[model samples]
Target chain A: MANPTAALIIIGNEVLSGRTRDANLQFLATELGALGIPLREVRVIPDIEDTIVATVNELRARFTHVFTTGGIGPTHDDITSECIAKAFGVPWEVHAGAHAKMAAYYAAQGTEFNAARLRMATMPRGVVLIENEATVAPGFSMENVHVMAGVPRIMQAMFRALAPKLERGAPVVSATVHADGVFEGQIAEPLAAVQRRHPALDVGSYPYFRPGPVRGGVALVAKGTDAADVAAAADEIEALLVAAGGQAIRGEPRLDDNTTAKV
Target chain B: MANPTAALIIIGNEVLSGRTRDANLQFLATELGALGIPLREVRVIPDIEDTIVATVNELRARFTHVFTTGGIGPTHDDITSECIAKAFGVPWEVHAGAHAKMAAYYAAQGTEFNAARLRMATMPRGVVLIENEATVAPGFSMENVHVMAGVPRIMQAMFRALAPKLERGAPVVSATVHADGVFEGQIAEPLAAVQRRHPALDVGSYPYFRPGPVRGGVALVAKGTDAADVAAAADEIEALLVAAGGQAIRGEPRLDDNTTAKV
Candidate 1:
């Protein structure tokens, strides 16, 4: 069976405004890749209610599962929960269990559970609450849509809590063959031939350069669900590099790495 | 007038596959923001032809301008240039200037100008060439859509060269007030009131946490094209933080940054 598809929606004006760099996309992408769920696409959008609602509805129907981060905080800009409710066409109401937990925690701390704080407990009428390790407030899932915190730590915790329940697929494995001095132009033809040989596997030719000294090279990576096919593609690519008169190194290339006699 | 809006389309399967972390989105966002072009949305999709063509067509119509990166190389996986031509319903062919430049560069190095290498010179007909500082290959602009390299250095060079011709809008100014020990629940209500007062500005409340020692806080950021309104909202947020009984700092909070007397 084909791997279940996933999409990520980042609902934040801060990220787009460049005030903050997003750390969640990399984490989520790596985790989802390991879990064998292929992430099809990712959308980073501003914190607009209509945009969030529309994007959520559109992606949820197309992908097997949709995950959203950011704008779930307890402030004026935090409108993701309500927008999600609007997308599902459900009533946005506070969950009894979540409300009780937050109310007790706030009461113990001598803090008032005001309207804004109460918004954390409110979500779609029918949803499953995803547990959070960082705070009493929890993210919930409506249908195939999973809502999580924007903060990297909290989002990770929420994802970890919900990971066990998600459906799994075959994990994609990749192998890399690096030719430090062989630039992409020299090996493009042979690499294309290698790609044609293994149509099912993905062959990627990445040309990399180190800026300070102007030293450069290329890395060929083969990826597929079948480990044997990926391995065979990698071997062929390594041979292709050797035939190009460049030394074939069986790994990824770092920024400072450079070693080849011929151009 | 409102800022010129931009949308970024990152075309790469490696990025979506979680093999490589994307560094271009943050750089482009910050650059576009400084250039008075608010980036409204970003989509990271795999190197699929139809997806690229459709996304390019849809975004070019909705946004003031669109910038795309990756898949414009000399390999089988590099299909961006052709896909863009298909999207615009134009023929994809090698530009004379680009072809001459690449051919001369290869001739100087005594390298064969193979067909795979020639693919880099090909692009959609009737497009302006964007210069590349890192390599001989050039990126191009097709009407409102700007296509650039995926590599950070090359992409930045291409964008810097293209920036002078882009339409600019009002540069967004922002002010941040951080309350180190204050949680969002304590100040959400008052923050919402501040947001209501300054409806023209975007008031964001971000709660931050430090992992090692388990310390957390909140930061309120106010942003808008109008400088005076942003400052006014920031002042109100600082006062609100003070009213919440937390010390208000006048800058952004870093990971190791911790200064608070009370919670």
Candidate 2:
């Protein structure tokens, strides 16, 4: 059977305008891949309500799950919840559970739940809260859509809460071999053959612009849950590189941190 | 009036998997901003025909201009033209101009137009060819949507060709100042105030991370089209930073490389 798939929507004017370099997408993609839930789409849209609504609807309908980042903060541009509510044709009202959480958090801090901050509690109805230990306001999930914070630290926290709920597949395993002084084209066909031989494994050749002063080489990585298959594929690929007049050094077989191990 | 907006659709499965670090989005965003046409959205989709068709329709309807990258290569995944043609309910055919250009290019290289390579010539009807001086198969445009290559160099050439056709506003000018020994939060309010004072200009603060032996700092950038306004606002911002116990040093003004001065 095909792996479950997910999509990511990044909402923020800062990201689109090149003001903020997004680190969340990379993190999410790597995490999802390790879980064997392939991320199929990523949309970066400005914090425009209509754009967000359209994207959320389209992506949610297409993928098994959809994840959104940014615009969940207690600010004027933080319109992610409202847009998501609109997308699902639901009412945009203050979620009681979320509001109570926010109130308790502020009460502990000896601060009033200011109206501006209360906006963070406004989430879609029938959504499960994704805990955010880093901040008072937590991210929430409605249907298959999981809304998370934009801040990298808070996002990581929210994902930690949500990860346990999702069905994970066999852990993705990867083996890499470093081949120094090799051009990409020289090994493309041999790598393709290796991939063809091991249909279950994902064999990839990546040419890195490694800071030549320190270390520079082409890294061939074979990844899949089937350890023996990936190992055999890596051996074949490395041998091919060696025959192509390149020095191939076999590396460690490590668990891909991004993929989730089956519970 | 608000800036004329554009949207980009990146069609490929390779990118969303974290397999390819996306370079096209940044290049297009920066280039479009420099030409005064703000890029409002970017969507990276897999090679699914239905998804591409739906996104193209939605974005084309919402934005003034739409540009799509990838899926135009001479490979099996090169189905952008067919999908786009289907989306518009138009007949799909090989673009004669595109075919002629590709034929000549192959002939020059002493090769025939193979069937696989010829697939790049197919485009939606009534589209104008966006010249690709860097490669044989050119990107084509229909209505407001311009379909371009995915490779960075080729995409850049296609963008350059389309640049002249676009009606640009005053180019967004930008100036940067480096500040050492100051945390990002320390100057956020002052910078926000500077932005409030000059609403036209966009003031951004970026915190830099230095490795083991180097010192870290923050870079404040002021960007907008009105030179005197941005410069004056930047001056005031610098003064505020200096008064706030930060050492701010002006670096350089960003240049418009896409457009040439008509002397």
Candidate 3:
């Protein structure tokens, strides 16, 4: 609960058009949670100038830090950099440091340093560049809004480089207690009671259904900044599942099977 | 494009806390896009009542249709139905029809219709219930805002059942042309030229990376309501790729290889 809030703006027409499933949100969410900065909101908008500018401005003003992915590439649709500048009401121009680094990197790699390649260096005036080891076309951070490549690999790299610079908060930890054969309908009231008992910590009931009559299952998660408190809540939840005749599992269920639905 | 716009509000602390990756947004986007309803914005928000109430109200007012996933189960965390009622300034109560149907179905299945299971029958006043064939706990539609289960299978079923009732819109179609060895930097200018020529159709350059220097690749997509216009623009895009010496492939690149970066 003491964690700093963050918001992500995914600027891609492809995502909105359902051409691709986003891989960034989960990676960013897990990383931010580890950094003790809970991701509060994520907005997936198209590659429209007005939408990008407005979304960036709105989220930046609301959350402690804002991150954007996609539309920072060297293409006509990659207008996130310019739209970000418009959001902050600053001049969009090429950064000398970024330009030098990219030009030298491209030359060494024998990649062309054309006008489009140079567009990667251009950003809002007085911005700090977030370095990406891959492709060398660095993502930049204008104020609190960190602009990263939409590609998952590059986005992860930029995030790691920038993670240390973020403001710290109490690390959020979670304890999962699964009920393999327990239905939510049977234990909803008691789980509500458990939540009321631990007002500071959140008690989440995740119901995972297998084919043929749901298999009547649930995964209860107790999460908070305080270790002892979270553990206590988890214990109470585990007891609840046991009393309700659940074959309780200590850890989170395997997601690879893909049957687990976090209801 | 004469496509109707849709916004999705993913209500879950699990998604925000990084415990679970959301699977509903992409499914909804693809489904809505097929219906000629372009998904304009998607918000992933926490399960907090205030956030849910505020987001539902905001999105309902903006887009032609607003759909919500998650938090509709029979648990303490399942508060989306109540929050939606709050958003509409209506009293949250169990609809007699839903209650009766669920009760009969549970009795037939030899499942206990307990207090928590009864909660599934509750909804806002004057709402039309969206029936789910899988589970007797039907999702409800209040005006333009449709509420579905967070579970992907259940959500998809509910959407299909409700799809026929939705207003028809101009169907959005796409034509994809892939340039496997051509980078965005190489064709950014000419791609812009193609975009300018098309004007109406949105041309997106999706650069895919294959671990070694991006493999200098991109997948150009021309999307719009008009089939002929999209095809013509795609043809021009393919010509542009040919002129740039790209080994142009028709249609979208393999997402199965999991290297396509939808930038």
TM, every model = 0.95, 0.69, 0.96
Rank order (by DockQ, best first) = 3, 1, 2
Residues A18-121, candidate 2: write the lDDT tens digits: 65667777788878988978788898987778879988998899888899988776544567999989999888788888888778877886665765567778
- CAPRI-style docking class of model 3 based on DockQ: medium
Candidate 1 C-alpha lDDT tens digits along A1-263: 89898999998998888877778887888888788888999999988989999999999999999999987778778899999999999999989988999899889978888887888898889999998676688888999999998877778888999999999888878899987668887888898888899999889988876544546688899988889999999999989999988889999988532222111
Candidate lDDT (C-alpha), each = 0.86, 0.74, 0.85
**Better candidate number, 1 or 2, judged by DockQ:** 1
TM-score of chain A of each: 0.94, 0.89, 0.95
Better of 1 and 2 by TM-score: 1
Better of 2 and 3 by TM-score: 3
Interface RMSD per candidate: 5.1, 13.1, 3.0
Q: Candidate 2, B181: how far from true, in Å?
A: 11
As a TM-score, model 2 comes out at: 0.69
True contacts kept of each: 0.58, 0.29, 0.70
For candidate 3 chain A, which ten residues in a row score worst on lDDT? A254-263
What would the DockQ be for model 3? 0.61
Candidate 2 Cα deviation (angstroms), residue B196: 9.7
